[model samples]
Structure formats: C-alpha cells, structure tokens
Target: MKHALIFRVVLGLILSSCLSSCGMAFRSEWKKAPVTSGVEGKWQGTWLSDENGHHGELRCVVAAPISRKLAVQKFFYHATWKTILSGSYEAMHTVQKQKDGTYTFKGEHKMPDWAGGLYHYEGTIKGDEFKANYKCAMDHGTYVMKRVR
Candidate 1:
C-alpha cells in the first residue's frame, strides 16, 4: 500500500511540474503588448514583382481609429513594365504585438472594381515601417512601406 501511495505522489509531481513549465512557455510566447501608434500616417514606397521584372510607385495611408479593430491601411499602387494598370486598395487588420516588439496582423483587402476578389494580408509592423505579404486572385507580392507623414 505504501509503495502504491509513493508511486501516485511521484506521478502527480511529475505531471504538475510539466504542466507548470508549459504554461510559463505559453505565456512568454503570447505576451500581449500595446500597438505602436507611429504607423498611423502616410507612407510612400515601391513594390517589386517576383515573377516579372515589373515594379511600381506606391502610396499608402494608415489610420488607427478608436474601435474594436486595430488599424486600417489604404494603398494606391501603379505598376508598369509593358503596360500600366494601377489600382487603389484598402485593408483592416487586427493587431497583436509579438515577443520581439514587432507587431503582426492578418486582414483582407477588397477591391473596389466590379467582380474583384478580396485580397488577404498578413504583415508585421516595426517602428516606422510596415511590411506585408498580400495575395489575391493570381497576384501575390510583398509591400514594403515607410512612414512619410
């Protein structure tokens, strides 16, 4: 009976220790922090295409209004290599601060034109810069933005 009791206690201690350590790691990995307000302004930059040699001038406006959502970004991009097709885009993302002080978010951008599919975005905000990977229909690229206003 004593051996069984001892074995049970040992097992309980092992499980408790393991669980406590796991909880600590989880808390550290998902530490909730404040959003950086510096990104709320205008940004101007360029985007380079990975498939073709196409490149373009980009203009973006960011706003962090007081609401349930964290931020909204509006972009006007014009890219030309053989032809010119420029479009204005916008997206809103829920912001979360990462462990490394950078912020990460995921959201969707809807095109204003007819029958245009929604483009999804996932990006990181660090200091005065924001970078995101965007995809819609058959188009995908990285948008690198710097605060200009």
Candidate 2:
C-alpha cells in the first residue's frame, strides 16, 4: 500500500511540473499593430523594381471617418502595357484593417465580380509611413508603399 501511494505522488508531481513549464498560449491576430492619428494621412510614394528596370508612383489618402469594415485607396498606374492593354490609368478600392494588424483591400475594377479580388492586401508600418504591400499572383510582383504625409 505504501509503495502504491508513493508511486501516485511522484507521478502527480512529474505531470504538474511539465504542465507548468509548458506556458503556451493561443495567438491569432491577422496583423501586428495599430495606426496612429498622424500615420493615418495620405501616402505618396513610388514603386520601383529591385532591378531598376521599372518604376511607378502611387498617391493615396485615408479619410477623416474610417469605417470598421472599409477604407479607401485610389491608384493611378502607368505600366508598359505589354499585357495590360492600356496606358496610365486611375483606380479605386476599399480597404479594411483587422485588429491583429493585418489588412484587406479590394480594387473596384472588377466590381460586382472580383470586388478587389486582385487586391486583398497586407502591409507594415515604418517610421512615418504605412508601408503597405500587395502580392500579384499573375505577375509575381509585390508592391511596397510608404506613407506620404
């Protein structure tokens, strides 16, 4: 009886120690941080190739009233038109920021069908700018943005 009692106590101690040291919690945030009032202004910057072969500029502004579900972005892009079939152009989209610091924005070009399907976005914030980035699966290109104001 004493051997059984001693075995049970030792087993309990070992299990308790292991659980206490595990210290693991569940974390689920889409992004990383929050936006400040000053960083919430228009951002104007360029998109250049890492190889210096191509470049374009973007001018974007956030509004006074930011909705919980949507923000706005306007883009004027000028590409070589090899496959684009056009020259310089203007476009718009509504963006959303998740509490976890992740963001989502959809362009308006494909409205009822795509609804910004091409622009589901993600970005990070630097010193004075919201460094937004979006990935293009078709072109295999990534856009980097900085806050202008």
The top-ranked prediction according to TM-score is 1
Give me candidate 2's TM-score against the actual structure.
0.39
Distance from true location, Cα of 64 in model 2, Å: 4.0
lDDT of each: 0.55, 0.41
lDDT of 1 at 146: 72
Superposed Cα RMSD, model 2:
23.2
Model 2 pairs whose backbones collide: 31-100, 31-101, 31-102, 32-101, 43-148, 106-116, 107-116
Best by lDDT: 1
Model 1 C-alpha lDDT per residue in residues 65-110, reported as the tens digit of each score: 4464544433333222222333343466666778888978788866
TM-score attained by model 1: 0.57
Candidate 1 lDDT: 0.55
Q: What is the C-alpha lDDT profile of model 2 across 64-90, one tens digit per residue?
A: 334444565544333321232213333
Lowest lDDT 10-residue stretch of candidate 1: 74-83
Off by over 4 Å in 1: 1-37, 66-85, 112-116
